[model samples]
Target: MISGSIVAIVTPMHADGSIDWEALSRLIDWHVEQGSDGIVAVGTTGESATLAMDEHKMFIKACVDQAAGRMTVIAGTGANSTSEAIELTEVAREVNADACLLVTPYYNKPTQEGLYQHFMAIADAVDIPQVLYNVPGRTACDMQNATTVRLAEHPNIVAIKDATGDVARGRELIEAVGDKLAVLSGDDATAMELMLAGGKGDISVTANVAPAAMKAMCDAAIAGDRAAAEAANAPLLMLHERLFVEANPIPVKWALAEMGMMENGIRLPMTPLSEGAQPQVREALRHAGLLK
Candidate 1:
């Protein structure tokens, strides 16, 4: 059970578009001290698509080295191609990541059988624990419940980061595969509702900014303390909504840069926070008490 708050951490960068390994190590230390139970490196929140292959492998290795056993490091090693995913999973194993998060194939809408086969091949390729990530909104190929249940039968496919944000469906998933696998929320906006409905924890975007609050909220909810859970999350509602005003790392990178945690640089095809959204992102940081 990968319970409690797990940050889908961002990949910090230098102004020249180089990986900022020093800041990244410091961020890892900060998250551990803030009570984040685990870290997911190079995930959607980490701006995976923008990272080159060499940088990706090095980032995962850096995270594993910096955490040094204080936190579980989940490497986001999924790819649109089956063999590519296997390649990355091999890297994950090489670095001794606690587990690997395999997102549903992106930009290629494979059939249910295709999804099953894709995951099956990766599972066969690696011996590490695996968590499936289903975010159709970004990947564009949603993993329906039936496909997910089928994949859950695999011994290596141990958990899921459900980001569909549909509570009824999430509850249905729990009812279908609850006892067999862990169900962690991936959507920060609906994290509370989904978790109360049986999710073990969250692979949270909000955790990047408010790690202690997110961890406390998860711990309280997992303990069935609804009041404490709600209280812990109240101050973060605005951040949950605003950090996403732009697509992902854009706003998150801005927030982190504003806090002096990372450089404001990002790879091509994704730019810095849109001018209009900068003030909102800044305020979200201030509202979350991350700003000076």
Candidate 2:
């Protein structure tokens, strides 16, 4: 089981918006040193939408190579087109990624049946462990608990990153598919609650800046230690909320740059954290003790 705080790490980029391999390596090493349980490379937060196919493959391969077995690497291999998704998953498998995280097809807004078939087809095509990512807010396609439970029967479909942020629904999914598929919380603010209700871990945006604290909270929550988990999470509430003040990766990438972890280089369509939101993110970072 790939559990605990699996960081949905941002792909470090230069001012010109090109991949910064050196900064990426440094970030990977820092995560390992900081006790992050695993890393999700080229996921939504990694700006997978902006990266070209070649760039996507390169980032995944680079993360796998850099981690060098120190931690699990779950590559984001999702596409609205099933064939494209299969191709990406094949690449992830070829590169020996620990697993692949596939967000529900976006834009097209496939039905539950379409969702099931799409996932089933990918699982059938690739033998690698797969984690289904269901963030309706972004994808516009919500994979309901029933559909998720149905897909859980597939051996390769090992987990689901539920970003719905409904603790009640999350608990229900865990109860239904907990034994069959690991239910990982994809929403940072409600992650500890989901974990306390039998979730395995979090595919976290917050972990991008405060990995050690996220890991500690996950560890405590997974171990059923509410007090410990709450203690670790209390300081992060502001961060959990503020990082989304702008679109994702916008605020998170800015947070990383503010902490001197990366350059302030967000791609077009997604601008740098606005001047107005900068202080809010900075204060959140300071509250989390990630900045001075």
Candidate 3:
């Protein structure tokens, strides 16, 4: 029952785009101090796509070691190839991560049956608790509520991160699988609504910059305090929308750098936040009280 704001933390990098271990340790410590319930290391926001296998393993292990049991560490152990995903999950387990966040297979776009089998195989291979990540916008594969319910039966498949941004559908999924699996929102914009509708928490991008605010909103929402949640979330609406003004991690990484939390370095294929978009992100950060 790992609930509340679980930050999909960006992997801090140097200007040359190499992993910045010192910055990463600082970021991890900051999250623990800021009251972040958990951290998702090397996930989509962490540039898992750009990181090499060795780098991915190293980052996850580093996150687990740095956190040192102060908070939950959910390693991103997903790949389009089932065997590759299994291998990553094995590494997460090896390093004693609290759980593994496995996104649906991308590009190849497997059938629902294939998706079910793919997730089940990994769950079977690794005894560690696994959280399903379904972000069709990025993965090109949508794990429907039915298919997700099917996977929820697996003991190791403990939860799902629904990024569809459909609150109605999210509610339906909550009603159907809420008893069996922990339904978490991966979409920041609609996270409050989903949480009020019985979601456990959010695997949040917004938490990257405003972890304490996100955690307060989640805590309030999970407690069924809509008024309290809304009060906490009102300031974050702009951030939820603007952080995606460019592709993820680009804007979020930039926002972090702006707050002096990290360097303004993003990898190839994911450039730095464009000059034109910089003001928009900065405004959102200011609105959230992250910047002066």
Candidate 4:
């Protein structure tokens, strides 16, 4: 199982909105050094919606190559179109990524049957392991517990990234699935509690800036040591909440730049962090001791 803190890593870009491949490598190295167990390249936090198709494939390949087997690399291949999702997943498999993370289709919301069929189609077409990403807040399409349970039966469906942030519901899914498939928390804020309740680990945005801390917390939680997990998580609570002060990757990209990890570069439709939000995010970094 690819467990522990898996960073939904940002795609570093230059001021003109071009991907900075060198910076991307640096971020990956930092994650490996910090002990982050895996990465989801070009996920929502990586601005998957903005990248061109070629860019998406190239980005995933770059992440896989840079990691060089140092950590798990999961390509974010989810799309509203089943064919498109399959193509991306193929690219992930071609690049030898450890797995693929497919989000529930957004916009044109699909029925429960549609959702099931869509995912089943991808799992059937692709031979690689797949992780279902359910973040209704972003996708506007919730894959209900029952639906997820149904999907769990597929051999190719290895895990589910439950971003609902509903600890109670997440626990229910974990209990229902048992070892049929692993359940990873997509919400950093409640990740500790969810893992304590038997969740595998977290697919985290907070891990972007605080990799080591996030990994340590995840390890402790998975070991069922509440005291160690809580101690490690206390400092990161601010980051877990504040990084979303604005739409994702905005505040988080800014936080990374603030820490000199990357430049303050984000694509359009998503702007740089607002002046008002900077102080709040900076304070979060300070609380986590990532900044002075």
| Model 1 spans with C-alpha error above 4 angstroms | none
Query: Regarding lDDT, does 3 or 4 come out ahead?
Result: 4
Per-residue lDDT of candidate 4, residues 191-240 (tens digit): 99999999999999999999999999999999999999999999999999
TM-score of each: 0.98, 0.99, 0.99, 0.99
Candidate 1's TM-score reads 0.98
lDDT of 2 by residue, 18-38 (tens): 999999999999999999999
Pairs in steric clash, model 1: none
* Alpha-carbon shift of residue 200 in model 1 (angstroms): 0.6
Local accuracy of candidate 3 as per-residue lDDT tens digits, 35-121: 999999999999999999999999999999999999999999999999999999999999999999999999999999999999999
Lowest summed lDDT across 10 adjacent residues in model 2 is found at: 174-183
Model 2: residues with Cα > 4 Å off, grouped in runs: none
Weakest ten-residue segment in model 3 by summed lDDT? 176-185
Cα lDDT tens digits, model 1, 216-284, are 999887777889989988889999999889888788888888888778988877898988899998887
List the global CA lDDT of all models. 0.91, 0.96, 0.95, 0.96
